[model samples]
Target: MPRTERPRAPARAWFTGPGFAPAPDPAADPAGPRLVCFGYAGGTPSVFRDWADGVGPGVTVVPVLLPGRGLRSEEAPYTEMAELARDATEALVAAGHAAPGARHVFFGHSMGALLAYEVACALRDRGLSGPRHLFVSGSRAPHLYGGPDGQDLGDDALRQLVRDLGALRPDDRVGSAYLERRLPVLRADLALCARYRWRPRRPLGCPMTAFSADRDPIALPAQVEAWRAYTAASLLHRRVRGGHFFLHGPARLPLLRELRAELTRTAEEREPSWTH
Candidate 1:
């Protein structure tokens, strides 16, 4: 006999504040792990638009939308790392993303890696639930984050730096009016990085995974490995191919697969086993 399709689970309605874009239907797996992703400087939630499918149905993908971009474009962008972290923490809490017993994880790239770490600290300070695992990609550990100081560079110089970092392709360089409009936001983000200062704090309790790209000059493998200092739990460092923005290319699939496996393992460990 032909089998009948099972009924779909009802979606859980959750608040997604200004700091985040809504996740896909939570009903897909209401109790599954949630993967909160933060993108690089001048990046938007759209960068992770296809991530839900990448991570599979067992995990919900939530991409953060920082102010001064996307729908929040009219709002002033934050220029201080601490302030952004505090506000991001509050936004996550308000949306139930940081509720006690919630199973969630975090993934961030470059500037976003720093932001994600700060947010995790903020949550812990408030006595809230932190991520099950913290994934940082293409960034130096917080204490060692000195920079090229692009915030003060002239528009031409700043654009050149972005190009040098492979953030801007050669073909997209000529006559791109959109790039000109985004420079301010990019500068503001750089200012956040330049002005950041890491203070001594207790190491976080969650395990961490640091992903470094072989060709990424800014965040070398050694710098990525330094993330071990921030977490008391185990640190797994994975090296992949491509440049700083490796997540945007061929490397992204394998990265997502690793994330899916990790998230699934964490969820299984959290579940209570039944004794026969």
Candidate 2:
């Protein structure tokens, strides 16, 4: 009989188990903060690959690969908010190592924003370090989404939903194929988003940056302002000149710049005269 070998683990799944993974720590950074970047709906971690480059040399960008997509395709997508937050918090704790002495930030767009915020609460609940800063883009406050009660819109209506937000086309051949294969995961994620219910808890102690597009139908000014109620720390609002998926191309530069500045400011506040 021939010998059988164990299957190899994928690259992205590295250090994603129980203990915190020892990546770079932001609090130790004399330059800036460590940042974990989250993606939009039906999207994966590849979205922020170039963020560190664009954000300049001070920040370190870590893209989160949600299960059921990217290298974790074999894993099942989470459908409930509690489960999703728990799973994400575990991986983030394992990956970021933002404990003991590290300070960190969360930068999430659309669905990713909600996931990051919830994970912060879950981290606090688990007696772990929560994100010190949160940058939410293209999403309203958690309570505004309410529930998935109206999620059963027609296909045409759904197309309009995507179009209205000007997201990446899920129909463009290769893109469509990827989306088709990944639709189950995406739908599960959307379901999680739909079912999420917000509890009126105490505000987050971290500073928050609410960023959005000037033309985004999904994010109104009022919706963006609701983010202010979630944090006792400084809350800043900045508007860009694009649609919901603005972070995909050159438009991402400004967003990255702002992130770098914030992280730099945070690092400076924690440890002054590092530049001197």
Candidate 3:
């Protein structure tokens, strides 16, 4: 008999749906510079939920919740970088966050950094105004997509990598139950990174900043520095203390300070002539 084949799965969105989640506070300024964020693999928007508190007033932190996790847990996750970028761009535009002349910024950590870069590029390609600044944290330059591979790792290796990346505490339980619940999603994200192929494109006009941890093994210094080629504007690399997930540790304070400073600067630059 001929070999049997399984049917292809239906396409599922990575976002909750056609809309974005509500801002942290109901009274937040609707027109302020929006800091749209994408989290690392197997990560949720909750990781950035508290950013608004540190950023204070004027800037709103809009964390983009990827599907197959968080509130959209029932949906299937995206296995390709382009798919994720397209979904994010559509969601941002549909939610009115990318309106012309609106002040906007993008911040992505680890895997999110790559996604954010693509989103910025996608918006620019569509003839839409891009962000004021792009902040990419804990990720290598997009051109090095074919770096080390982790997609084919077995379950044990996959869990180990996550733990090594600081996603899991040493004391926390890591029985089959935990792995069973988290590994699949993480594996999908790794696959996306592994299979990614960065196509050459015009450098973005927006200023780009790359954040890296001094000791991060994955996003090494050289890899971080490679981000310079992606932007036509200035490219600055700032380092903090910790490993891959430094943003959640001691580096948190300084990271927020930098973010706030950029937000403030952008807002000031865009101020109306009458206000001066």
Q: Over 4 Å off in model 2, which ranges?
A: 1-22, 25-32, 149-160, 169-175, 266-276
lDDT ranking, high to low: 1, 3, 2
Candidate 3 lDDT (Cα, 0 to 1)? 0.77
> Which candidate tops lDDT?
1
Higher-TM-score candidate among 2 and 3? 3
Choose 1 or 2, whichever is better by lDDT.
1
Q: In candidate 3, where is summed lDDT lowest over 10 consecutive residues?
A: 6-15
Clashes of 1: 0
lDDT tens string, model 3, 1-276? 994442222222332432334423346555577888889987766667678778777776778877677666776777889877987887777666777776788999989999999999889989987888899999999988764468789878877787787876456555556556767788888889988999999888888888889889899989998999998878878988999988778798988887887787744563341131
**Cα error, candidate 2, residue 228 (Å):** 0.3
Question: Where in model 3 is the C-alpha error above 4 Å?
Answer: 1-30, 169-171, 176-179, 266-276
Residue 64, model 3, lDDT: 81
Candidate 1 global TM-score: 0.86
Clash-forming residue pairs, model 3: 14-67
Relative to the true structure, candidate 1 has a C-alpha RMSD (angstroms) of 10.8
Expressed as tens digits, the lDDT of each residue in 194-219 for candidate 2 is 88889888888887889878777777
